[model samples]
Every structure is written in structure tokens, then in C-alpha cells.
Target: MSNNLKKNAISLPGAIAMSIAIMAPAAGMMFVPQVVAQYAGSSVPLVYFIALIGSLFVANTIVQFAKRITHAGSFFAYNSAGLGQTMGFLSGWLLMSGYFVFYPQNILVASFFSSQIITQHLGINIHWSLFSIFFIVIIWYLSTRGISSSMKADLYFVGAEMLIILIVVFAIVLQGGADGHTFEVMTAKGSPSGWSGIFFGMIFAMMTFMGFESAATVAEETSDPKKNIPRAIWGSVVGMGLFYIIVTYSMSIGFGSQNGDEFAKSILAMDYLASTYVGDWLRIAVAIAGIVSAFAISLALNNAAVRVIYTMGREKVFPSKLGITHKKYATPVHAINAVGILTTIIALLMGFIFGPYPVGYGMLGSFGTLPILLLYVLASISLIMFIRKNHRDEFSLWSHGIAPIIGALVMLLPIYGSIFPFPSWPYNLVLTLVLVYILVGFILGLVLKRKTQNLVQDVNKIISSDGSEKL
Candidate 1:
């Protein structure tokens, strides 16, 4: 094994695919809109639009940073360039936590939805845990096949995943929907609780866009990363942003916008819309595709998590063993296994504790979301500091200053929702657990204060001495 990841192995499309697949478009649309519908009512589309704006604010900061720093530890490196070793390590630590928790969500979701299809079509009884184990093994194997294999797998899966969902969404528009198309569904007036309710729904709406940053993690491995990584980041955010808005509006009207309560209450909104607007065959097809979408997500996230962990390993932030790559595959072998292994352990634990349907998915997904939101807040601050310190002459009042400030403030909405007027049990447990996890990292940072210079030096040497693209 060698301590190197294959450079220039990924192209622009591969990077774009990585960012989009991690969003799990099909799985996200299938699951999240209904949750948003609960408060936004028929205004689900409006809520998503607002969330898209918030995402853009964060995206701008990431894009600006990507133009200058290209490294495998995407966010970590960006933060390090601006914030120094301690804050940078903490940024990576929170992001790594988010990814580790995010991976098992796909295992649980894939098993939950696939289980429905299997029991309905084949008349076989199988526990979701069995399906969970099946998926865990498949993800581990696919990940080990190396970066090229994983990126190719996601391209096909995300394409097919987008196709089936779009067909159904467009079909609803053509049919003039269940209530003959009303503009009311797209208005703030559509919400049951007015603007406040819309704000609340924005919590889940923002969560759906969680994985858009997956592209940034592969900067070191991608060709023309300075250009490609920023483009990939914008491509995912804009592409998925529009996709989320249109599809949600279609579902709202398809369910007779006034029936938002019923829409939110459905077990699987996509399956319901498919069976109603098209046919049962379409529902079955979506179910099958949903499984593929979930797998694509699992695969994409595993690829990203490995790089983050690999970067940390190389810098001695974590065990050195995790820094090694396979000689043939040129993939971070130990990092890949660590991601898969942690996912496997969590899948069984959460599945047994909560059952893999609505409860398990909610608990895990929310747990994953809280930290990343905080990470973005910190990263936005890092952008300003990075620009002012390293590229002082180029810093702008807006781009490096005002924009990152707005981005940080925008991200605080969801972080606020996660706490104060606290979420109930389980979710409360997640909040508590995440706080303790971060606290532990903070304590570790203090303990290693003297060694921080070494940490930053190792992180810096990972990037070659070549000049960066100008801001």
C-alpha cells in the first residue's frame, strides 16, 4: 500500500456527479418534501425556494475558497488556509462526524423502501436488518473497487434516478394536476401557519441540500480542480435547487394542494404520486429506482468520507494507518474500510433501536445534519479570514466580506431550529450527543496545542508549491 491517492483520476463530470449523487436527489425528493409539507402546507415549493437562497449564500463562500485552495481535505484545507490548524481540524472533525452519520441513513432508507417493494411484489418476508446488512456489504465492496469505479457507478444511477422522477413530475404538470393547477400552492398564503410555519418547514428543506458539497472533497484527485471544483459546486447547487422546486410543486398540486396534511402523512410521497398519476407499475419502478438512488448516495458519501479521513490520517490528526492507499487501486484502503465499518455498526444499532422507517431515518438524518450546518457557519468565517490574511489585496467588501457574513447568518437558521425550543427526545439525544462529540474534539485540540504547528505544516505540504488560481 502507498500513502497516495490517484491524482487527475476524476474529470469534471465525475466531480459533478459526485456532488449530485451525494444529495441523493431521488431519495431526498422521495422523503423530504412530505416532511416539509407538514408546516409549509401547500407552500412546500416556496419553502424550498427560500432554502435554495440560503444554500447559494453558503455556496458562494465555498466557490471562492475552491478557486484558490485545491486539496483532498476540501473544507479542512480551506479552513486551514484561513483559520489555522486548530479551527481547521475542528472544521474537519465536525464534517467527518456529519459524513459518518450520513452514510448509514442510506443503508436504512434503502432497506426500508426496498423492503416495501420486495414484500409487495415477491411475497417474501425479510427483516429490514437483513436488507441493511446486504446493502452494507454492497457499499463496502463498491467503495473498495476504487474511485473510478465509484464515480462511474454514481453517474448511471443518478441519471436513471433523475429520469424516472422527472417523468412523473412532468406528467403531473401535463395532466394539469389533481386540482387543475392552482398558483396558490406556490404562495406564502398557501401555508397553514403563515410565514412562521414556512420558516419551520425551511429546516427540513435546508437539510435536503446537505450533500451538495461532496464535490469539494475531491479537489486533489480531479483534473483542473480550481476550475472544475467551483463549477461542480455551482452545477450541483443550481441543478438540484431547480429540481427540488419544480418536483415539490408538482407533488403539491398532484395531491390537491389543499390536502397538504394528507400529503405529509403519506408513507412515501413519491410512491403515492406515481401510483396516483401514472400506474402501479410506475410506483414499482420508482421503488426499484429509489433503492438505486439510495445506493448511489451511500457510494458517493463513502468516497467523500474516505478522502476526509485519509487527509486527516496523512497529517497525523488520526491514525497513520488510515492514510495508506492500495497499490493497485490507488484508493485509501483503510479509510474506505473505516467508513464502511462504522456505517455497518451504526446501521444495526440504529435499526434495532428505532426501526428503519420514518423514525430511524429521521433520527439519523437529523443527527447528520446538525453538525454540517455548524461546519458551514465556521467555514464562512474562515473564508473572510483566509482572504484578508493570504490574499489581502483581492479581498472585496462583498465577495470575501459581506457574502460570507450573510452566508454564516443564513446557516444559523437551521442551527437555531435544531436547538432552542428544543426538539423532543431521541432528536434531543442527537443534539446532546453531537455537543459532547464536539466538546471532546475541543478538549483534544487544547491537549495538542503544542503540536499544532506540525499539524498545519503537514496540511500545507500536501499541496504542491505551484501558484494558485487568482481570485
Candidate 2:
């Protein structure tokens, strides 16, 4: 009946590894390669660097936020505590929506890649949607098992994924494709868009690095969050940023100066190019990496989303049943089920809504990027406010105030660009989800609040007595 709950079952290393598994999804490197190739074209690696720098500001805000609050809901709770109730609820709802999207988005990616491997390796033709459904069910089952199981799986996935990435990089080096592709491309100008292309392409580029701040949300479960969370956040940012830069640059070079068409296909489209350089084995390995990468993203998001819903339930904002933890598994079974069901429905509908292209993949990715940036934007403002009003001792001018203020402003750019009219389908899909989510969560939260308030209050009262005030 006391306020404290059991800690996150995963260790700090496992959490970091799991977090890396989440953030370093190999699919990330493949996402904007075409956009970069199309607009920035040869200069796409520069876009990666540009995006990495911008993403670093967001990562800094996340690390700072983590230093202050150790909440399972990450930026949602941070925004709520730092800003106010309404904004916090909005933030939580937005974040929850983002996390919810992660499930389908990832399943789409995994299903697609898994199908590719099956078709290529086994000569079996299966529908991607069915495979996607199968993968979702498996991911849900694994998620319901516990964070420890998920994290352990992540360690294996992460190792395999990274190996494939290294193989691709090594292939590029061994082939001696381009002497200065990575550095020289930045200086080349696009056809009509020129620098504007890179600027706009930067939006897509930044999205690839979306999961770097995931460590903050899992802080409550970490063993020594104060030290570990901060370290993990920053370490993740720099490490993952470097990884993106290397893989992106390597892939572009491996594709050769004239192979823009091949690189334009998808993030791992270069895996085909890798075959030319390193042979068929590495290409198959890369496909396996993609599947694992997608699965890892699902694992991380499921872990975070379940915790978010459980936090809401614990706070009396949702049904208390959702707050229940499985006694044997010690996992948030109900919350996991709720999140899984919601994500699966969304994924199925997305398939119908957008057809074979997997609208869920792009829509989920875009929307996920926005709420995260908004959370950072709000967090930056909150940090400034939090320092000015309460903790003058925490103020270092740059660390507590100006840096976050600037960080918030910079983070706002993509959010603005994303919602504004763009010719891109991904942008519009993101915009639709953002507006739809806010409207849906607003109405739902209001109704759920009204319905659950008395119940939660009554339950809290009864639990406080431990039989003294029997129902």
C-alpha cells in the first residue's frame, strides 16, 4: 500500500544495452538515405552529421531531464512536473501515442525484412501482413514475459546487428570505392533544391536518430539512475551518433559515386550493394540484422509504453486494473496487453488506410519524432522555469538555463517543419497522426478521468487501511 514500487528488474548495463538495441535499430541508417541521395544526393553524409548535431541538443535536454526526475514515463512525467497538469497530461498522452505507434511501425519493418529473407533464402512467398501479425504476436508475448527477458534478447540482437553493420563498413573499405565520397559529397549541389534539399532532408535525417533518449524513460528501473541514466543518455547520443555517421558515410561510399539509384531504395537498400562488394553472405546477414533491429525497437517501445500506462494507472488517471503487476512475472501484464492491442489495431488499420507501402512505418516514425522533440522543447522550457523558480542552486546559466532554452528553440524547428505542408507523404502522415492523437487523447482523457476518479479514490482509501476499512 505504500507509495514505492519494485525497481526495474534489468541491470544498468542490460538497460543501456537494451536502450542501444532500441536506438541503434539498423533500419535507422537506411531511412533517409534516399532522401539524402535525392536532394543532397552525393552529399547525404553531411546531412547525417547535420542531423546528428541537432539531435545532440535534444539528447542533452533528455540527459538533463533525467538528472532531475527518475520516472518510468520519461519526458511525459518530466513535462507534467516541470510545466503543469494539463500540459503534462498532453505530453504523456502524446508520448504514449508515440510509443504505441512504435509497435506497428517496427512490426511493419520487421515483417517486411523477414519476408524478404524468407523469399530470398527459402524461396517461399508469404504475405507480409501475415508475417507482421505473427511478429507482433511474438513481440507481445516476449514483452509480457518481463523486462529482463526483453533486455537479454536485446543484448543478443544488438550484437548480431552491430556485426552486420561492421561487415558493411568493412566491405566499403576493402572495395576502395570512393576516395572522398563522404567528404566530397557535402560540397556538391543538388539540381534545383541545392542547399535547401539538405536542409529539408535534415528533417528525415534527424528522424533516423529518434530513439537515443530512450534511457531516460527507463531510469526508474535502473540501479543507480542518477549516475547511470545521465551517462547512458549522453553515451548513447555520442555513440549512436558516431554509428549513424559511420554507417551512413560507409554505405554512401560503398554505393559508389554513380550508384545513387541503388542507395535510394531504402536504408538497407545498400545491403544489395554490400553483396557486390562483400558477396551474398553479408547481404543475408544484413537482412537478418534488419529483422533483429525491428524486433529490438518493438521490445524497447513495449517496455516503455507498458510502464507509461502503468504509471498513469498508479496515479489514478486510468483504471487501477492496468496498474496491476503480475505476481509471478512481475510485469505490467494488463498495460502490456492494452498497448499491444491498441498498436495491433492501429497497424491493421494503417495497412488498410495506406495499402502495401506500410503507412504505419512512416506515420509512426514521423509522429514518434514530433512528440519526442516537443517533450524536449517543453523540457527545455521546464528546466529553465524549474531553475528560475525553485532550484537556483541547480542553475549553471548554460547547463540549467540558456543551453536548454536554445536547445528548446532548435528542437522546435523539426516539429514546425513536420506539421507544415510538405510534398512528402511521410510528413503528411506524421501531421495527420499528430493532430489525430491530440484530439483523440484529449477527448479520451477527459472521459476516462470522469469515469475513473471516484473509483480510484475509493480504491486508494480501501488499500490504505489494509483490512481496517474492509470493503
Instruction: Tell me the whole-model lDDT of each prediction, alpha carbons only.
Output: 0.84, 0.69
Candidate 2: count the clashes: 2
* Ten contiguous residues minimizing lDDT sum, candidate 2: 462-471
Model 2: CA > 4 A from native: 1-5, 179-182, 187-192, 257-262, 265-268, 356-360, 424-430, 439-471
Q: How does each model score on TM-score?
A: 0.96, 0.87
Over 1-471, each residue of candidate 1 has an lDDT whose tens digit, in order, gives 988778888999999999999888898899889999888888999998888888888999999978877778878778877788777778888889878887888889898877877788899888888888887787778778778778988999999989999989988999988888888888887788898778778778877798888898888789888899999999999999999999999999999878888888887898988988888889878887888998899888888888999988877778889989989888888998888778889988988889987788888888788788888998999999877876788889998989889988878876776686787887889889888988987777666555556656654553334545311
Question: Could you give candidate 2's per-residue lDDT for residues 218-310 as a string of tens digits?
Answer: 666677776788887777778878887777767777766556555665555657666777788777777777778888888787787888888
Winning model by lDDT: 1
Deviation of model 2 at 99, angstroms: 1.3
CA displacement after TM-score superposition, residue 255 of candidate 2 (Å)? 3.0
